[model samples]
Target: MKRTTGQLAVVIAALVAGSATAQDMSKIVNTPHNMANLDVWGVVIPENQVCLPCHTPHNARAVEDGASQILWNHALTEQTFEMYTTAAGHQGGQPEGTSKLCLSCHDGATAIDDFGGNEDTFDNVMIPADRLSNMGTDLRDDHPIGIEYPPPDLTGYNDKSTFTGVKVVTINGVDRVECASCHTAHDNSYGKFLRQTMEGSALCVECHDK
Candidate 1:
């Protein structure tokens, strides 16, 4: 793959930015993200390596446009999405940051065995269409991702700092909500890898005043 000077610069920038964040490997063995434990995809990762399906220590694959890097080992999704838009004119745009990484498997576009440069012989083996985890590419029905958080008016939304469980990702100096905001990939104690329990709408109210 030939990369222009600008593209190389972007990749370098992403590498630097990605290296700053810590990788949380705790509690993933019990989660669905533990591909080796599932064995449904027919990919035999040596020694039941739970992290290899999504991450690698060296030579991780670069995502589309080199937007962000996180030792990403899985094949990225190329599905064009119908983004979410709110009645108040808030646009979710395309998936960004960790959201894109999550979609690598969840979108049902990239095969489950399509990591580590392996041929995708099990292309049919993907997240089941009926499952809620298989969000597919049509994101219009889901909560908005890649959207600026704490709307300019701050109407019906709590201050970003008030969020104790969920988090917002900063993209290009602007704080935005991504999948990681609500879902902590390494931890699933709350179920669904949610940063906090949704019981009594607790997670929803973390950022939403309603």
Candidate 2:
């Protein structure tokens, strides 16, 4: 079959996008070379089961709170976090969606090895208390999640038109900001595992008006 110029261009664009995605996936930190017995924390499991700690094909949908369909191999966090708030406009709520998945390890509540519905046999790996990555349950000091951005209105959030520019990922059909918005859970091409560079506050400027 002969293809039109537009169709050829679309195919080329898709190939390029796929190549970029594959490249980024290769650079992610979840590889066996990076996570397999690396000198990270004493609590980490020494096994070479890299992605097994967080994902699985079957039985992932067996878990609760709509976690199974996402291939969530890890256990959900049981702790309730102290959520974020602004002095004037506060809309944050309890952790949900991907943010909850991140807290599965980062909140310092759940064990890293406690996944695949088998925490007993797994090594007693956990993010340490001293590490900055251990965000704990209290989030009043951290950037906000589980909240809606200011709506397009006149009196309340009308002044902050630039908020629309901040990156966001939709979950359950609602445009919400989750931890994955700013950070990559698996990718670390950015030195700090951030999704983008922070030089000159470029990442911050993506959402903030200033």
Candidate 3:
């Protein structure tokens, strides 16, 4: 049976829409699960050695500072990070735990291949020296994290509940924003691994008044 031109147009539209859908995996190559494929995490691990870059099955690297721990396989960065500050003369600095874990890979101080007891799995596997994604030891320009925000009910936000309602990963009993608060490490359901849509600053406005 021959389909009308209008029918073909509709079918094509649907196909295009489906291709752009959030969960479309082909459009998602840089998600954390596929870190080996990223320039920041540039390396070619064996198919079986994927997670070995950041995780391990036995005797994982122990988190040295904070109480929070993971199966962390990568070596932590050595630099003392200059954290974000509020208007009150640079208070509210210092990332807690999970954020530090991300910095292990993104802070541009640690090597992408610097994991598994600092084993050299690949040559020159560190992230490039300079890039926006390569957030250096200085974090003054970035959004504030590791700082306490008003809990449960806050009057500054349009929806005070929205402020506290969104994901807030705590470390060592402190309610602070870590990298994972806005990001999904293994999932790209939202672009750039954001936990929710940032459209119209949808994610920001949820917690801010503006």
Best by lDDT: 1
- TM-scores of all models? 0.81, 0.72, 0.77
Which window of ten consecutive residues has the lowest lDDT sum in model 2?
151-160
Q: Write the per-residue lDDT of candidate 3 for residues 1-210, one digit (tens) a residue.
A: 899999999999998888667446433343555655664445666563657777888888888655557688877777788876666543455555778788887788677777775464555455566666788888888887776554334455453346532576666676656677777666666667776687788888776777
Residue 39 C-alpha lDDT in model 3: 41
lDDT of each: 0.80, 0.68, 0.67
Q: Give the root-mean-square deviation of each candidate in angstroms.
A: 16.4, 10.0, 4.0
Clashing pairs for model 2 are 43-125, 60-68, 61-68
Ranking by TM-score: 1, 3, 2
Q: Go through the candidates in order and give the clash count of each.
A: 0, 3, 0
Error of 1 at 197 (Å): 0.9
| Residue 145 lDDT (model 1) | 87
Q: Write candidate 2's Cα lDDT for 1-210 as tens digits.
A: 999999999999999999767767436444322445555654353365677767877877344445225787888888988987766566567787778888888888687778785667866676879989789999998988875644333134323334432356565666666787787666666556676678887667666546
- Quote model 3's TM-score: 0.77
For candidate 3, the lDDT comes to 0.67
List model 1 lDDT by residue over 63-176, tens digit each: 654446778888877788888888888887777777888898889777777787566454446887888888888898999888888888558989877888998888778888
For candidate 1, list the clashing residue pairs, or say none. none
